[model samples]
Target: MNIDHNDEAIVIVGSGAGGGTLAYELTKRGLPVVVIEAGGYLRNEDYVNDEWEAFNQMAWLDPRTTSGSWRIARDFPNLPAWIVKAVGGTTTHWSGATPRFKAHEFAARSTYGRVDGANLLDWPLTLAELEPYYDKAEIAMGSTHTHGRKPLPANNNYKVFANGAERVGYKHYSTGPYATNAEEYDGRPASIQDGFNFQGDKNKSKWSTLVREIPRAEATGLLDLRPDSQVVQITHDPTGRADAVLYLDKDGNLQRQAAKLVAVAANSIETPRLLLMSGSPMFPNGLANSSGQVGRNYMRHTTGSVYARFDQPVRMYRGETMAGVIADESRHDPDRGFAGGYYLETISLGPAFLASFAAPGAWGREFTEIMEAYSRTAGLWIVGEDMPQESNRVTLNTSVTDKNGLPVPNVHFDDHPNDTAMRDHGYRQAEVLYEAVGSTGSHRTPPYPATHNLGTSRMSARPEDGVVDKWGRTHDVPNLFISDGSVFTTGAAANPTLTIVALAIRQAEYIADELRVGGI
Candidate 1:
């Protein structure tokens, strides 16, 4: 049944790890949900395995601008982020590494004690508070090496990475905490060892909101899923509560959906863009920008890559793209010349991507030489906590409008000193690891356009400090919420997808209870 435009229904935006999971959780509990996605739906059978072809089919290639001193500006000026715009969102393109946030990471401000040039804040809650939800999320996602799920087999790339890690004296290296299955669980089949995991898993072994949460939510018959609908504005009543959302359908016609409760999970950049665009007389600054913090404090985790060439043929791109993780460095030791630590995970890209990302603009000999050594190469990615700065932010660039004539978000970022230190350390350590296991040479690649965009509409303990509260409810608008990584207080050293899913699960429980008691 169609949810009428006048009916007060539960509405969610986007369909990624957060919004898609929240949709399933709420619908499974007998609540009706309407999910409006900005892109068209592409099923598992619809995925294209070729890297560049798949990228073109799924990437959010909208008109966006990038600024500040980040290398991405020089390399990919119009593509600030490499997120997917399809119905499942970026979850369709993630690497499937699901590491939990460490306990100390939740209390970063209290533990680190005031680093200069950082907007550090302790999470309103703690790891202990979220552990149970993490467990639930893990079980729901069928995370390997957790709750009786078996880990995926090690590929040649992981074998090489593990040997190097072992020679370097790293203790905690593993094939898991990954979300792909080694054996069938929860009706999804085991991995067929496909290297196209990054291009949307056609085999359905990897976990994505598209493969799991969305289908389950649809099965409940309580979901109204509308793809290719871009939300433009959230209209509010005179009492300052969100009442409706106005969006453009696939036909470019505007439609309004009345919402009793609205949850925005449109990733970090667009979530705030929508909120900022919704400014009215009641909320002159933005919907939840009473604290003037709607689009401030943007973070894309500190990232880079190290690829080494060896004498033997590793053929790294023969199995899962990112199945191995080295957790020994994922700690908070200031002795490492940085405030936080990083993870070194095995990664293997197709030859086309390897050439493109190995060196953005290199010449004939050096570039071709690297491509020629593809079979003999092994690589890993460095992902660490990047300090959030109030200056690094997403703002409206009215000069460049999107296809629908809306101002696109301009992402401005400058690497924090801590981020630089951590990246340098990661590079040195990766080189050492490769050398210890016999590498001829290694190349350090600058960060790609961000996939882990986070923290634009952060959560705070007090209303004056942030946009949302501990429950993800906007401090200025009670019925409005943010159910994505945009609400991250601090980006922990681990990946954000698992945490995003866990938070959505926890948020769903709270929202469901509030709905029952008429609390909103």
Candidate 2:
């Protein structure tokens, strides 16, 4: 498994929260690393003031180019799934709602009993075990919200919801920690509360993983970042260990990069796709697919939106996409007749183009009236937990191919009955809050596609049920690891960026320890 240069380096596939954090941790410990990102580098100045343009620049927009994109399915017709392919990945456009999964979330199956047709399992690690890493990730990302800190300022939106939740006897409080700058902890500039809107000039800042960790990794002189390199496959040796990677350069020229340890941080979809594509006699099903679980257990938090037209302007466009969150209904309580949890948050309604799509009205004069009334309206996003089902999986589509001639991932997924029930509970609760806020009109938005996809390459204690072990090491391939949301065993009812960063940090320590002991 020797290469021309015979260089030994840790190769990471993506530069999102997981990959970037891993690179930072490993390089800080004086380990050499190579990070490959499919998108080019972008700065804060590149972010514009138009929501549509900002979304396009921050995410994968085109349908054709993203035909084989992760979670963008042809099977589910009206669902809108958003994914990013840039250097910083989807973190560039993330709403920055950083909430830690509850302690019970790790043991949902054991606590709430078995979910039919679902693979609900407790996490190998507990929340207490990962709390330190969460704190580190939050500090590193300059998270602004005061969740585990002192009393936070209650915005008008938060007060309205909290008051309503208390009146209804729901145990609601503000625990939604955001990954934005609260104060100048790092060398970066302090957060300006005035510029909280997604497309406002004041919202500009360098807060992404690329902006934080990649620069530090580069300064270490042990990490090499190669943007615009699309990884095609992982090349393995006769012993079934990943030795190198085949990728297409920016100019579309095929090239190879050798490494001793390969970290597949290519998100949930692309990671499995890459592994399945790297087929050989030793791994005919796919690399590390002996258990046939490389792309199983796919899960995403089912999201619902509650729109309300208040008598007075709620000033929806004044702050970040996610400025406040409600956690009263976000804990799993089996006595509630549902097997999942949900969280509520106040989000911005972008300008005309984006707002029309999110809050669309029927055609004719009604549509015009709804559009005119949007100036006095605001809404809340209800994100509910979806149980991990083995039937909801991501397998290769032999019949479908991408522009690069690679087989696209076939995503077969549907909501569980419990998930729908949880959503209904959230919707009803949201209606109560909206009515309490003196809303003239209120309606629940239809179920749309979720961006927080997880559990394609889950982590378990044994290889019989997961692609990676508790430490995220591949079962079949030693020296190969996975560090991303794909490794989640259960999908918690919260945003996953902070959790992914914590896992990456923990994985880096494990890899570092193994390297020190000459153990793969």
Candidate 3:
């Protein structure tokens, strides 16, 4: 079980949804894996329910710079994303919504056609090709409203949201396809309905790599899950094959771990950052920058929120943070003045987050009134497909360095015309939905630091168009793979965690088979 530096082990960076799941899958198949994670391991019992305290404890607060015309730049200039630096990555902080991507979403270029200033591309694979893996991921996550799993009970927030949806003439509204448990399954207990699903599910009922995949992988005795080990660079051999990795251990010591193959799953921002940092004479642009698409075409899913206040108390923060979803608007319609679609899903923030994010810099009576009406507020988030732009990207900012003296990632974004139109349509539709439920007043919240960061290294059938191929293997480096949301060719309307899990599952199978045949 002790994999030495020279052992034939697969080194996976960033133990999030992708790396964590891939570690388990490969280890379960009798392959040795070394999972290098940047943050320390925090168990379910270690999670704090308080919002601000939990954010400090689990968030990746390392130095990052942002540049864009997007409102996030004006509001939260330093924090470009709200992902975790813990063992489970953002899965510990996710809302547990697990909606699958629509079939048309895979072919965004073909379905939506070309829009001005949008860099749209069709995915290498289709929904049909990933369906079986989706099923496997859903079952593994114990997703509600799928595979005979009972749905989570509708809370008061969902009741109001669903009622509004029905009144608005929407057809599909449900309390699930969510990943939280309705009853005990997979050895994890049923949800206690503690409403702390966002601040790390302490109950162990919600699916996260910390609760499920990492522990299972550890049990196999083939996974060397090294926490607090920050992977810095991937080294390649003379023939351009990745051979080893250099990382900073917990005590600030540099360590080298040899690898038969390397898989980077360090989220979209850090994944591209690591690849860019590994640049050498053989591959000057970056490790996988033969297409110059290593950090281009970034998509954060055009996002916003609508919070409505009612006469009676709604107590939106009673059960799950995100459970109910209305999928009627997730269809592609050119008449909507946008290329891709979006989803209106229930979202409840604690009083602190609501006050801070409902309106970032508003003051005086308006902000105070929103705080006072917290008990009677029902809110839903607008998550839709944001167009990929060639200019929006993550690049290394050598001016700002982290504690390790490594350059931090500078995320630059600009809203495409399609993104702006889609967000506006979503806000109007959300107001209509809330109005149908007799809401006294409504407030529109601008997009927060993105939780769903995707498509810096996209998948493409041709090598010149993207960083990875259909199997997630980097087109330039046969022994290097990108096992994260960065491989998404286009952002879909659905929550991205489920698709990320499915892709990791499929990637694992391919990796194991290729290894068996000595192909990489």
Tens-place lDDT digits, model 3, residues 340-445:
7999999999999999997897889989999999999999999999989989999999999999999999999999988889999999999999999999999999
**How do the residues 43-161 of candidate 1 rate in per-residue lDDT, one tens digit apiece?**
98998889899999999999999999999999999988999998889989999999999999888899888999999998899999999999999998888989988889999999989
Per-residue lDDT of model 2, residues 1-520, tens digit only: 2133444888999998889899999999999999989877776667677767766666643222222232334423333346677777777767777788899988777777877777888878788899888888877776665434322345556666667667777775663577665554566654565433343223434267756788899999998888988888898888888899888878887878888999998878778888999889999998888888888888778777877777777666654456678887787788787886888887656556434454344367645655677767667788878888877776777776766777777666777788778878888888888787677876666554557879988888778878888789998899899999999999988888889988999999999999999999
- State residue 249's C-alpha deviation in candidate 3, in Å: 0.5
Candidate RMSDs in Å, in order, are 1.4, 3.2, 1.5
Model 2 spans with C-alpha error above 4 angstroms? 1-6, 61-80, 145-156, 194-206, 353-356, 359-362
Q: State TM-scores per candidate.
A: 0.99, 0.92, 0.99
Query: Considering lDDT, where higher is better, how would the candidates rank from best to worst?
Result: 3, 1, 2
CA lDDT, candidate 2, residue 413: 70
